[model samples]
Target chain A: MTHTQQQNEHLWQLMFEKVAGVISTKDLHYLEAQLREDESMQEAFHAIQISFGHEDLERLKEDEDWIDILSVIKTRPRTTHQHRFGKYTVAAVLAGLLVSSAGLYFLTNRKTTPPLAAVTAGESPQAVVLQLADSKTVLLSDKTTNIRLGDVQLHNAADQLTFSSPDNFSVYGGQHTLIVPVAKSYRVTLSDGTAVWLNADTRLQFPFSFNGSSREITLLSGEAFIEVAPDAGQPFIVHTPNSTVQVLGTAFNINAYNPKQVRLSLVSGSVKMNTHGAAVVVKPGMEAVYTPPEGLYTQSFDEKTVLSWKAGKHFFDKASLSDICLILYRHMGIKAVIDSSLRRHDIHFNGMVDKHKPIQEFMDDVKNMTGVDYYFDAQGILHFR
Target chain B: MKRKVEQHNDKQLLRRLRTGDPNALNDAYRQYRVWLLVVATTYLTDEAEAKTLVEDFFIECWDKNLFKDVRVPLRTFLFKTLTERCKKQGIQINMYP
Candidate 1:
C-alpha cells in the first residue's frame, strides 16, 4: 500500500477502535483531523462504531441472511419489529446514510444475502401452533417459522416468535394469542419490542402493534417473564383472572397458573399489582403474592429459583413434596399421587429438575435421593410410597 | 438468469439509496433489524440495549455513509463493523477462543 493508503488505514483503525470505546482523548485529535478532511473516514468511523457494539456483532455479521431480512418482510408488510419513527423519517435518515458515496458503496457492492427459507417439516418441533385472529391455525413445527398476517409479520425461530413490520404497511395492529402447551416453553417479542418468555401451558394474548396509550395483554394462564420496552407514554399492563400488573418499563415474572394465588416477582423496575381492587407496588428484587380475598402481600424471593425455568431447569430450596408433585404434573404431564402411607412424609427437599430429561428419569433421581420409593400403578399414575 | 435478475435488483436498490432515497434504507432496516437484534441479545442479554445499539448502528450507517466502495455484502459489512466495534470495546465474541 502507498504511504497515503497506509496512513488512511491506520486512521480508520484508530477511529474503529474508538467506536469500541478503547481510544484515549489524545488519539481523538488524530481521528478528528482525518474525519474532518475526509468524509469517508467519518462515515467509516461511524459505521464501525455502530456495527461493533460488543460481542454480538460478530454473530450477526456471520449470518448470511441478515441483510435480506427486510426484503423477505417486504413480501408481507404489516408485521413490523421495533419502529420508533415513521417509515418516511426512517427512510430519510437511512437515505442520508446511503447518500455518502462510501456508505452507498458499502451497502450495494457487497453480495446480497439470501432471505431465510421457510421452515421445512423436519426443521421444527410440531407441538406449538398459532391461532390467528381469523381462526386460521398455523402449526409452528420448524426451527424457524415465518407467517404474514396482512401487513404484520410473525417470525418464530428456536422457541421465540418476533413480531415485526414491513415498510409500506403503516400501522399493523391487531390482537393475537400464543398458546404454549405443557412440557414446552416459548419466548415472544411483542410489536413494541417487549419480550415475554412464556413457560409451559401459557396462553398469552397481545396486539400485533400498540395503538392505544397503554399496552395491555392477557395472561390467560401459566407463567411468564416479561421485559417491557421502555415507553413512558405507554404503560405495560398484564391481566390475569385474579390480578393485574402495571409498569412503565421493567423486567419481571408472573406465575398465575393458580387462579387463587397470583405470584408477581420483579427482577428490576417497579410494578403495581392489583387484586380485587386492592393495589400494591413491588420494587426490584421483591415479590408480591395476590390472593383475591386476602389481597396482595409482598416478600423477597430467590431470583435464581424463580427465573430458573429460563435455563430449562427448576430449583427448590426447601420445596414440599406435594408442591413439587404439582409442579412436576404441571410441567411434565405426570400424574403424581402420594400414597396414604407417605402422605405425612412432608418431604421438604432441595433439588433441581432438568426439563430436558424424561419425567421418569427425574422421578427416579428424586426418589433415590429422597428415599421416597415410587412405582407406577395399574392406571399409569406415579404413586410415591 | 435468476441470479442476474437479483443482481440487477440489488444494483437498482443501491443506486436509489445513493441518491438519498429513504425507502431503500427503510427496506433494508425492516429486513435485517430482527436478525441484528438477535445477534445483539446473544451478547447483551438485554433486549432493550440490543435494540438501542442496533438502532444507533443504523443511524450511524446513514450519517457516516459507511457503505462506500462496498466490496463485501451490506450484511457482511455491517457484521464486520459490529465485530470490530465490539473488539475495541474489549468484548470477547467467542467464549471457547
Candidate 2:
C-alpha cells in the first residue's frame, strides 16, 4: 500500500474504534485533529457517522427523555415520567414524599447507636457470631446447624445463613445482629428475602420478620452488598452511620468503614440517600457519598473497582501506605504497623490483594515492587520497614 | 418558488423567536431536532451527550437572545451556531460547500 493509503487505513481504524467506544483519548484527539484540517478526512468521518446514524437514531428514539427539554426551557415543571419505577406504586409514593418532606423520616432516626464492643478491633472474634433477640449469642462456623428463633429458622449451610419464616404477618419479632469478624465474610438472607453479603469486620442488624410499611435494617459498621427483594408495600431502608439509603427494590453496595463518610454505590435500580437535611437520588452506576459538614453528593463510579470485594479481592488504585496497612488489617486480621521512617515518606501502591491467596504472596509482591520489607513480629503483628 | 417560500416562513419564525414566542421555539425544535441530532452524533459519537448538546444549543439560543441579530437564513444561522459549538468540543464538520 502507498503511504497515503496506509494513513487512510489508520484513520479509518481510529474512526471505527471511536464508534465502538473503545478509542483511547490520545488517538481520538489525533483523529479529530486530522478531521479538522483535511476536508477528505472530514468527509470520511461523516460517512462513517452516517453509516451508523440509522441505528443510533433508533436507539435514541427508544430512550426515554429523562429531562423534558421544552418544559425546562419554558421555566415550567419538567415532570418527566419515571417509567422505570412505574410498577412499584409504593416506591412512587415514597419518592414523592421524599421530595416534599426533605427526609423527615431519616432525621427522626438520627440518634447514633453505640458501637458494639464485642466486634471492636484488636479483640476481633475468629468466627461469625449471631446474637439473637433474646441476647443469646451463637458462634457460627462451617459445621454449624440450624437455629430456631420464634417462627423463623436460621438454616446454616457453610458460610451463609438463610432465614425461613413460615408466616408473613408476624409482628416485629425483635432485632438480630450478625457480626462478621476480621479475615472472614458471611452471607445472610433476611426473612424478607433480601440477601446481604457481609464483608470482613462488618456488623448487620435486622429483624426476624418485617411487618410494617418499611423493612428497616441497620448496617452498624463495615461493608455489605445487599440485594433487596421487591416489595412495593414496604420499601427497604438501610441505616448507616452518617446517612440513610431508601431502596424500593434494588441491589447496591454500602461502604461505611470510614466513620466520617458513607459511600453507597448503586448497582441496579435507584436509591434515595438522605444525610443531615440534604437528600439526593442516586441512579445506577453512580455513588452517593455522605460526609458530615460536606453532606451528600453523587458521582459516577467504576463498578469493577467498587464491587470487587464480593469476588474476594481488594483492588487498590494509588492507595497510600497507611491506607494499605488499614486494608490489610481489615481483610487479613493482621495488624500492619509501618515504621516511623517509612511512614513519613509519601508511598503509594497499585495492586490487588486476593483473600483466597496467602498474605505472604502479597507481601512479597509489595517488597519486590517497592523494596519495602515486611516481617511478622513476636506478637504476630506485621511490621513494614 | 419552494425555496423562496421556505425563506419567507423562516423569516416569520425568526421574528416570533426574537419576540420570545414559545410556539416558535417548539416549532423550531420539531422541525430541526432530528437533523441537528444527526449532525451532533456524527461528531460527538456519544448519543446522550449529543442530545444534551442539541437541547442546550436551543436553550442557550433563547437564553442569550441570539435570534435577534440573525443576518443569514434561520436554518443557516442555527447550523453555523451548532457547528461552532461542536468545534469547541474539538470535532469539526464541513460547512455548506
Candidate 3:
C-alpha cells in the first residue's frame, strides 16, 4: 500500500486499539488529533466505539446505522454486488406463489443472459421491481438495466441500483417506488446523491427530484438504511407508517416491519423521529423507538450486530428460536416447522451465519451450536427436533 | 458582536506576538498548540511531518506577521491558512465534519 493508505489503515488499527483500552498515551494523542480533523477517521472511530464490545453491541442493536457505513466502506462502486450462493440455492419459489395472487404479468428482458435465465411469468418473478410515476411497472431482470427520465439516469446492475443526475437537476413533481422481494436485498442512490439500502419485502416511494423545502420519502413497509446527502437548506425526511424521521446530513436506519412499533437508529449526526404530536431527537449511537401508546423513547444500541444483514450476514445476539426461524423463513426461503413439543422457543442462540450458505448448512451449524437437531422432511419443510 | 469580540482578541494576540515577547508566543502556543497539531496531523498523518509543519507555521508567523491584520478569529485564521497550505502540499482536506 502507498504511504497515505498505510497510514489510514494504521489509524484504523489505532482506533480499535484505543476502544479496546490498549492504546498508549502517544497513540491516543495522535488519534484525537486525527479524529478532530478527518471526517472519515471520526466516522471510523464512531463505528468502532459503537460496534465492538458486548454492551456496545447492545448499543448497536439500539443505534444500527453503522452497518450502512461498513457496507459503503467494504463494498465500493455500490453496483453489481455478487453473492456466491451454495449448491442448494433456490430462486425463492415462495415469492412466485406470493406474486401469483397479485395477478401481475411479466415482460421478458431483451438482453437476458444464458447463464442466468430471465425471470419467467410464473416460474421465477423478478426479485426487484421499479414502479414509475406514470403507473408503469418495470421488472429489473436484465444484468444491467438503465432507465433515463429527465436529467436523472437510474442504473440497475445485479444487487445495486444507482441514480445519477446533473448538478442543477430538480423536479417539481413525479414519484417512483422501488420494491424488494422476499429473500432479496437491494441498494439505490437517489437523485440528491443520498444512498439507500433496502431490505427484503420493502417498498420505498421517492420523488424523481426533491424540489420542496424538505426532501421526503415514504416507506410503505420493511426496513431501510439512508445516508442523507449534506444539504442544510433542505432536510431529508423518511415517512413510515407509524413515524417520520427528519434528517439533516446524517446516516440512519428505519425498521418499520412491526406494525406496533417503528424503530429508528442514528449512526452519525442527528435525526428527529416524530409520531403523532410527539417527537424525539436521536443522537449518534442512539435509537428512537416509537410505539403507539408509549409514544417515542430513546436508548443506546449496538450498530454492527443490528445491521449485519446489510453485508448479507446474520449476527444473532441471543436471538430466540422462533425469531431465528422467522428470519430464515423470510431471507433464506426456508420453511421452518419447529416441533412444539421438542423445541424450546425461549432458548436463544448467539452466533454468526453467512446467508449465502445453504439452509442445510445453516441448520447444521445451529444444531451444533444449540444442541438441537433439525432435518428436512419429505415435503421440503425444515423440521426441528 | 461575538465575531467582533473574537476578532478583537485575535488582533491583541498578534500585536503582542509582534513585540518579540517570548510569553506572547508561549500564550499563543498554549491556546492553539493542541488544535493546530490535530489539524496538521489530519493532513500529514505523521508525527514528524505534523511537527515540522506546525513549527514552519510559527516560524513564518514570527517572520511575516501572518495574522497581523486578520479580521476573523485566530482559530478561524489559522485553520483557513493551514488548510490552504495542506491543499498546496497535495493533502486531501475534508470540508465537512
Candidate 4:
C-alpha cells in the first residue's frame, strides 16, 4: 500500500475503534489531532460512514438469510448448557397429560355447584373459579357483586377479585385457591394488599389473611406477575413447585408452566431464589431459572418479551411446533393436532400471538407464513397439515 | 427527508429490540446484514472471513447485550461495529477515494 493509503487506513481504524468504544485515550487524541489538521481525513471518515449505509455495494448479493444467522448462533458452542426445555422434552409430553388430568380433577372435585347468581349466562366452561377456605368453589363472573366466606369478604368486579377482611386478626386462616382456566386471566388483591395477576391456566393458593410472621403463598401451576406490598417487618415468600422466591417488597414474574422448571424474572427491587438448599440473589432485569437436577441458572432477560403475556400477547422466537401447539392449547383452549409428517420435521415458528384475537386469525397467520393449511374438526380440535 | 424517516423507524426498531422482540431482531438482520457484510468485505478480501466477521458482529451484539447501550443510529452503529471487527482481524480498509 502507498503512504497515503496507509495513513487513511490508520485514520479509519481509529474512527472505527472510537465508535466501538475500545480506542485508547492516546489513540483518540491522535485521531482528534489528525482530524483538526487534515480536512481530507474528515471527508474520508464521512465517506466511510455513508458508504457503509449504501445498499448497492459489490458484495451485497452475498447476504445470508436471517434463519441462517439464527442457525449459526443457535449451533455455536456455549460456555453453559442453558437450554430451558431440552431436559424436559420427554417430561413435557408426559406433563401435558398430567396438566389435563389435573384440570379434570379440579373440575370434578368442586365441593359445591356454582350458585345461579355467580353463573352468568353464556358462562365459559373454563371460567375462573375461586375455592374458599371452606372448600366451596364459586365460579367467578363479572356480575358477582360480593362473596362472604367466614370473616373474609371478596368483591368481584370486571376481572379483578379484591379481598377485604373485617379485621386484621386471623378470623379466616384457611387457605383459598384461585384457579384461572384456559384462555382467560384474572387479577386478585390479597388481604395483605399485594396484587397478583394470574395468567391463563394458573392456580394460586394463599390464606385469606397473612397472620404469620412471613407472608407465604404457593403457585400451584402456570405463570403470574406479582407486585408485593412493601413491609420491611414482614417478608413475602412464594413457593413454586421447584423453587422458592423470598422478597420483602418487589415486583416480579414467575413461570412454572413446566413442572420441572421455575423461571423468575425480577422487574424491580431484589429477590432471593432458593432451590434444593442452593440460593441466589436476582436483581432487576435478571432471570433466575431453576430446573431441578440441572440446578439454577441466572441470566439477563428482556423485560418486554418476558412480561408480554400481561399485555395479552405472547412472543415466540424459533419455538418448536409442539411447544407452539401446547401454548395454543393452554392460552386459547384450542387443541392443535399437527400432521405426523410435519411433527417429524420439527417445524418452528417465530412471531407473536394476541390472546384477545380469535384463534382463526393466528391460524391464518401461520398458514400464510408457513404454507401450512389448517381446519377445525367437528369437535373443534384444530388440525394442521 | 426520506432518510430521516428511515432513521426514525430504525430507532423504533432498536427500541423494540432492546425489549427482546425476536421479530425486531429478525427485521433488523434482514434490513442491514447485507450492507454490513458489504462493509466487512470492503476491508477484508477473504469472503469467508468477512462473513464470519459480520456474523460475529451480530452474535456479540446480542450475546453481550451491546445493543442496549447503543446511542447512535442503528445503521451507523452496525456499520462501525462491523468495521471494527474487521480491523481486529488486522485487515486495512480499502479507501475508494
DockQ of all candidate complexes:
0.05, 0.03, 0.01, 0.04
Q: Which stretches of candidate 1 lie over 4 Å from their true place?
A: A1-126, A166-173, A317-320, A339-345, A358-361, A376-381, B1-97
Task: List, residue by residue over A1-385, the lDDT tens digit for candidate 1.
Answer: 1224335434644554465443457778877876777655555555445434556434343435233434433453332433333332222211111111222011110112211111121122225555555433444543343444556666667888886776456543456667676667888888888999998777788877777889999998889999999999999999998888999889999998888989999999989998787899999999999877877799999999899998888886777778777777656656688888874565777888887887777777777778888889897888888
TM-score of chain A of 3: 0.64
Tally clashes: model 1.
36
Q: List runs of model 3 lying over 4 Å from the truth.
A: A1-126, A149-152, A164-173, A340-343, B1-97
Worst 10 residues of 2 chain B by lDDT: B1-10
Q: Rank all candidate structures by their DockQ, best first, as comma-separated numbers.
A: 1, 4, 2, 3
User: How many angstroms is residue A252 displaced in model 4 relative to the true structure, after the best TM-score fit?
Assistant: 0.3
Tell me the TM-score of each prediction against the true structure: 0.51, 0.54, 0.52, 0.54
lDDT of 2: 0.68
Best candidate, DockQ-wise? 1
Model 4: pairs clashing at backbone N, Cα or C within 3 Å = none
For model 1, the TM-score of its B chain against the native B chain is 0.72
If ranked by TM-score, best first, what sequence of candidates would result? 2, 4, 3, 1
lDDT-wise, the better of 2 and 3 is: 2
What shift in Å separates residue A117 of candidate 4 from its native position after superposition? 23
**C-alpha RMSD over true interface residues, model 1:** 16.9
Best by lDDT: 2
**How many backbone clashes does every candidate have?**
36, 0, 9, 0
In the range B1-97, model 1's lDDT, one tens digit per residue, is 0111112234555666566555776655654565555444433433454555676566555554554445544554554565444333221222100
The models' CA-based lDDT, in order, is 0.62, 0.68, 0.62, 0.67
Per-model chain B TM-scores are 0.72, 0.82, 0.72, 0.81
